[model samples]
Target chain A: MSDLSVDLGFLKLKNPILAASGTFGYGLEFEPFLDLNRLGGFVVKGLYYGPREGNPPPRLVETPSGLINAIGLQGIGVEAFIAKVLPKLQALDTAVIVNVCGASEEEYVRVVEALDAEEGIAACEINISCPNVNKDGACPAFSPESTRAVVREVKRASRRPVIVKLSPNVTNIVEIALAAQEAGADAIALVNTFLAMAIDVETRRPKLGNVLGGLSGPAIKPIALRMVYQVASRVKVPVIGMGGIWSGADVLEFMIAGARAVQVGTANLVDPDACLRILGEVEDFCRRKGIERLEDIIATVKT
Target chain B: MFKDPEARIVGKESWGDYFLLTFDSPAVSALARPGQFLMIKVSDEPYPLLRRPLGIHSRKDKTLGVFFKVAGIGTALLARKTPGETLDLLGPLGKGFNIDPCLAGKPVLAVGGGRGIAPLYFLAWELRALGASIKILYGGRTQADLPLADKLRAEGFDFACSTDDGTVGRRGLVTELMEDEIKAGGGSPPALVCACGPDPMLQAVALIARDKRLPAELSLESRMGCGFGACWGCVQRIRRDGKAEWIKICEDGPVFPAESVVWEKESP
Candidate 1:
C-alpha cells in the first residue's frame, strides 16, 4: 500500500484529510456516526479569550453552490475549551488542532499561551480572516506586517506549531502566505471563508441577521484551488487548502494543485459523515490508480 | 438516534410553486415526533450555504415527508426534484410539540394558518387516535392556499376555515373564528390550545389565551443552520424568572408555552 502519511513539519497525519474548523464542532459531536480515531485529525471550533455569544440571528445564508456565515466566532472561549472540551478531545486518537480567533494580537497570544500548555493540542490554526466580527481598524491577517506580527507573537508564546489560516478575501494570498511563513509559522491553512452577503428582495432586507457572512462551499472550490496552488508554490511551509470541498475528487484537485492537506468545511453540513466518506473515496481513488503514497500527488502541477 | 444510512428521494409532487418531497430515512422516521424538523441540503452548491430547515409533515415506516413552499432558490430546486434522486438530509431534530397525557380525554383546539398547518396535521391525527376531541381551525390568504383541508375533513375532524378574501367558511382571520368558538362554548377555555402559523396570528391567539389563563402551546418557525442544538441558530426569547432568556428552538422547542414567548420582540 502507498503511504498516505504526511509530515506537516511538527504534526503527522495518517491521512491528508482533516475536518475544517467550525464545521466539525469538535470531534465528539460525530462519535455517534463513526470512529473518530479512523480519520486524520479534527480542528475544533474557533476559540476566543472568553466565551462568546456570537452574532445575531440569520447568521448563515445559502448561496447557489456554497453558504455564507457570519457566526462571529461563537465559541466557549479558550479557558472553557481547555477546561471542559479539551479533556474529552484529548482522549481521542487523532490530532487536535485548536482554531484561535482574537480581536487583537494580544488576545491571540493569550489564547495561544493557554493552549500551548495543554497536553493534547497538536497545533494551533491561527484564524486572522474571520469576517464575522468588527474589532481593530484592521485584521492582522489581512496585512503583511500584522500577519507576520501575530504569527511571530504566537510562535514565540506557544510551544506547538502554529498553522496560520489566511483569508480568501484578499488581493494576493501568496503575499500573506509568505508573510506568515517568514514570521516563523510552521504551516499555513488557507483560505478562510470569503466575505459575502444576501438580501431578501421582498422584505428588502439582508437575509442573514449579521448582514455579512463568510462564504464557503462547492462554489469556492475553483478559487480555493487556485489560491492553494499560488500559495503552495510561493511558501515553504506546508499548506492546508479548504473551501467547499465535498468529495475525494475535490481532495485530489487540491492536493495536485499544491496542498499538503485539505480541510472539509460546508460538506459536513450536508452530510455528517462527509469527512469519513471523503477519506474512503480518497483511499479508493489511490487504490484504483495503483498509487502507493498519497503524498506523491501534492503539487503535481500539469505542465 | 439511529444513523440515517441513506437519503433517497422516494416521492416528489408539485403544487404550483410548492413541492412535497419524501425522503427515505428510517433513522429520522424512527426517532421523529410531531413538531420536529430536518436540516436538508437542497443542492451541493454553495449559493445556499446552510441546510434548509424543513418541518416533518409525516413519517411512515422508513420514510419522512417534508412539505416546502418555494420561497427561495433552495426550495425552488427542491420543488423540481424527481423521484429516485438523492439529496443529503441531517435529522429528525429539535424538540417537537408536547402532548399532555393528563388532558387526553379533554377537548383540544389546533390553530394553523397557511403552511403552519403542516405540524398540526400530525398533532390532530395523533390526538384523534388517542380519543381526544380535536377541533382544527385553519386560515389562508385564499381558498387555494389551504393545501390539506380535504385530508383533514376526510379524517372526520370537526374543523373551521377562514380566508382574508371571504371566499371560504368565514371572512377575516382564523383567530376571529377561534374567539367566536370560545364565546359559544360558555367562555371557558378548551382543554388546551396548540397553534402554529404566522407570527402575527400566533401573537393574537396567544394574547387571548393568556388573558383567559388558558394553557396554550405554540410552534415557532425560524431560519436554521444545523437543526441540532450545536448551531444555536434557532433561538427565541422567553421569560424566565421575570427576565428574558434566549432558548434554542432547535433544542428546547419548536414548541413553547404561549406565555413563554416574547410575542412582540424578534427572536434573540
Candidate 2:
C-alpha cells in the first residue's frame, strides 16, 4: 500500500484530501453519510468577527458544470463556533482547519487571536478572497503588496499554521504566492472560486441575488490546475490546491502540478462521500503505479 | 439511510411538460415523508453536473415517484431517462411535513400550481393513510398545465383546479378558490394547508392562510447544489416569533409554516 500521509510543512495530515470551506458545513452534517474521521481534514464554514446573515436569497444557482454562489460569508460568529461547534469537531480524528474571513486586517487579527488560544485547531486557512473592504485610500491586500501586509499581520496573531487561500481573480497568481511566502505564511492554498455570473434571459436579470458570484465545479478545474502549477513552481511554501476538484485523478493532477495537498469543494455537493471515494481512487492509482508515497507525485507533472 | 442508492425505474409517464419517473427504491420509499426530496443523477454527462432535486410525489410499496418539469438542462436530461434504467440518488432528505395525528379528523388542503404540484401527489397519499381528509386545489397557467386533477380524483382525493386564462375548471386563481372555501367554512378552519408552487402563488397562499387564521405549511423552492444540506446553497427568509431569520431551503426545510415565511421579500 502507498503512504498517503502529507506533512504540509507545518501541519501534518494523514492524507491530502480535505473538504473545502462552506461546501461541507460543519463536520456533523455529513456524519450520516460517512465517518468524518475517514478524511484527512475538514475546514468548517468561513468564520467572521460578527454574525452575518449572508447575501440575500437566490444566492446560488446552477450553471452548466458549476454553481454560482454569493453567500457573502454568513456564519455563526467566532465565539459561538468555539462554544457550540468546536468541541464536537475537535473530537474527530481528522485535522480541523477553520476557514477565517474578515473585511479588514484588524478584523482578521481579532479572529486569529481568539482561535490562537483555542485547542484542536490544526490550522487557519485565511480567506483573502473575501470581497475586501477598504476605505483608507488602499485596495484590499489580495494584490502582491496588499497580500503581504495581511499575511504578515495574520501570521503574527495566529498560533496554528496559516494557509493563505489565494484568489484566482488576481492578474498574476505567482506574484501573490511569493508575496504570501515572504510574509511568512506557513503554506498557500490556491485557487479560491473564480468570480463569474449567469443571466436569466426571461427575467432580464442576473440569476444570482448578488449579481456576481464565485463559480466552482468541474468547469473551473482546468483553470485551477494551471494556476496551481504556476504558483507551486514559483513559491517556496507548500501549496494547498483547490477549485472544482472531484476525483482521485484530479488530485493526482494537482499534486503533479506541485500541489502539496488538495481541498474538495463542489464535488462534495454532488456526493457527500466524495472525499472517501477520491481517496479510494488515489490509493488505487498508487497501487497500480507501485508508487510508495504521496509526496512522490508532488510537482511530478508529466507535462 | 442508504448513502447513494441506484434506483431502478419501474414506470415512466409523460404529461405535457411534466414527467413522472417511478423507481423501485424500497429503502427510500420506506423512509420518505411528504415535503422531503430526492436528488437524482440525471446522467453521466459532465455539462449538467449536479443531481436534480425532485420532490417525492408518491411512494407505493417498493416504488417511489418523482414528478418534475423540464425546467432546464438538468431536468431535460432527467426527462429523457427511461424505465429499467437505474438512477443514482440520495434520498428522504430535509425536514418533511409535521402532520400531527390530532388533525386527522380535519381536512388537509394540498395546494400546488403548475409543476410545483409534483410533490403534493405523494403528500396526498400519506395524508390519506394517516386518516386526514385530502382536498387538492391545483392551478396552472392554462388547461395544459393542469396534470394532476384526474390522478387525484382517481385516488378519491377531493380535487379541484383553477386556471388564469379560464381554459378549464374555475376561471380564476386557485388562491381565490381557497378564499371562497375559507369563507364557506364549517365550525373552524380546516386542519392545515400544505402547499408547493411558484413564489408569487405561495405568497398569495401565505396571505390566505394568514387571514383565515389557519395553520399552513409551504413546500418552498430554491437553487440546490447538494440536496443533503452540505453546500448551504438554498436559503429563504422566514419569521420566528415576529423576527425574521434566514434558513436553508435544502436543510431547515423545503417546507415551513406559511406565516413563518416572509413573503414580502422575493426568495431564490
Each model's DockQ score: 0.44, 0.68
Per-residue accuracy of model 1 over A68-159 as CA lDDT, tens digit each:
78777767789988888899988889988999988888999999988877898889999888877864213677889989988988889988
**Model 2 CAPRI quality:** medium
Residues B172-224 of candidate 2: C-alpha lDDT, one tens digit per residue: 98889888777776676678998999988899888877777888999987778
True contacts kept of 2: 0.71
Q: What are the runs in model 2 whose C-alpha is more than 4 Å off? A: A131-141, B186-188, B265-268
Worst 10-residue lDDT window for candidate 1 chain A reads A134-143
lDDT of 1 by residue, B1-268 (tens): 3345358889977666656788788766888888888777766645566677777887767888887778877787777777888767767777777777776777898999888887887788778777888899999888877767777798789999999998877998999988888887785469989999888888888988877778899998887766665555566777777876556677677888888888555422
Candidate fnat values, all: 0.46, 0.71
RMSD per model, one decimal: 3.0, 2.4
Best by lDDT: 2
**CA shift of B130, model 2, Å:** 2.1
Query: Relative to the true structure, how large is the alpha-carbon lDDT of every model?
Result: 0.82, 0.84
